[model samples]
Target chain A: DVKVTQSSRYLVKRTGEKVFLECVQDMDHENMFWYRQDPGLGLRLIYFSYDVKMKEKGDIPEGYSVSREKKERFSLILESASTNQTSMYLCASSSGPIYEQYFGPGTRLTVT
Target chain B: DQQVKQNSPSLSVQEGRISILNCDYTNSMFDYFLWYKKYPAEGPTFLISISSIKDKNEDGRFTVFLNKSAKHLSLHIVPSQPGDSAVYFCAASRGARAGNMLTFGGGTRLMVKP
Candidate 1:
């Protein structure tokens, strides 16, 4: 079975603080994604990495960036956290043509 | 605009009955569809999937039916159990994309009563 692990399951930060959320996959998948899920909005992509050092912006990438320094790890960075950024963040990884992504336990972020 | 939509926000079913969750899409380019189940404080887990070429796919008690002409799909759970209660999301993807990034619908929350 494939396993995707997130660094934190719950986090709290003050406004204007910078936050980093890390994800690691044991399957060595080539593609990793970061998504924020909000009530009534579903899951919206924030950023995705196809390979090491390569990143692309998704539908909702504002105020957020990503890092993929290694194949197994992907990181999501919140440049300046705000109360609006408080939501459940999910990390997923997939490989090959089968687009079946394995997800990690989400990180629920609270910005006060 | 929401590409994928789940019109019903919540559903209730009795245990041992059938639970039907529906999803609709506006994009004709979507060639693959998937269903995911999620619990509170947890990430969504892949449930079942169907390609454009097939109308139905089944795994155990869960089956997915796709209507390409209507651009809609539904997941049916037979003999629903209490453990099956969760939020169900419908997602679609264009096969031509490199990673096939998925566009998801607003989820439907399912509650099963015993």
Candidate 2:
């Protein structure tokens, strides 16, 4: 079975603070993704990494950025956290294209 | 624009009954579809999937039916149980082998009453 773990299950930060959410997968997947889930809007992609040091902006990547220094780890960074950035952040990893993605439990961020 | 849509925001079903959750997509380019189940404060988990070539796929008590002509898909859960209560999301992908990126629906909250 594939295991995906996140650094934090819940976090609270003040405005303008720099926040980092970490995700790690054990299956050696090549793809990692970051998403934010909100009520009614569902899950929106923030950023994705196809390989080490490779990143691409998803639909809503303005306030977020990502890092993939290694294959097993992916990090999401908030340059300046705001109240609107408070949402459930999810991390997922897949071995290849169009494959099932294993997701972390999620990090519920609260920017006060 | 919302490419994938789940018109119903929520549904309730009694135990041992059938629960049908529907999804629709506006993009004709989509060739693959998937269903995911999510609990509160948890990430969505992959449930089942179907390709455009197949009209139906079944796993255990879950079955997904796809209508390519209408661009609609439905997930049916038989003998629904209380544990089945969760948010169900429908997602679509344009090219299955090219990339894993997917467009998701808003999701339908299903409550299975005991």
Among the numbered candidates, top DockQ falls to: 1
User: If candidate 2 were superposed on the true structure by all CA atoms, what would the RMSD be?
Assistant: 1.1
Correct interface contacts retained, every candidate: 0.63, 0.63
For candidate 1, lDDT tens digit of each residue in A3-107? 999999999999999999999999979899999998877899898888889898898999998999999999999999999999999999999677788899999
lDDT of 2 by residue, B1-114 (tens): 899999999999999999999999999998889999998877889999999999999999999999999999999999899999999999988785333788889999999999
Q: Give the worst 10-residue stretch by lDDT in candidate 2 chain B.
A: B94-103
Among incorrect, acceptable, medium and high, the docking class of model 2 is: medium
Model 2's DockQ?
Answer: 0.67
Grade the docking of candidate 1. Answer: medium
lDDT of each: 0.93, 0.92
Best by lDDT: 1
User: Each prediction's Cα RMSD?
Assistant: 0.8, 1.1
| Clash pairs detected, candidate 2 | none
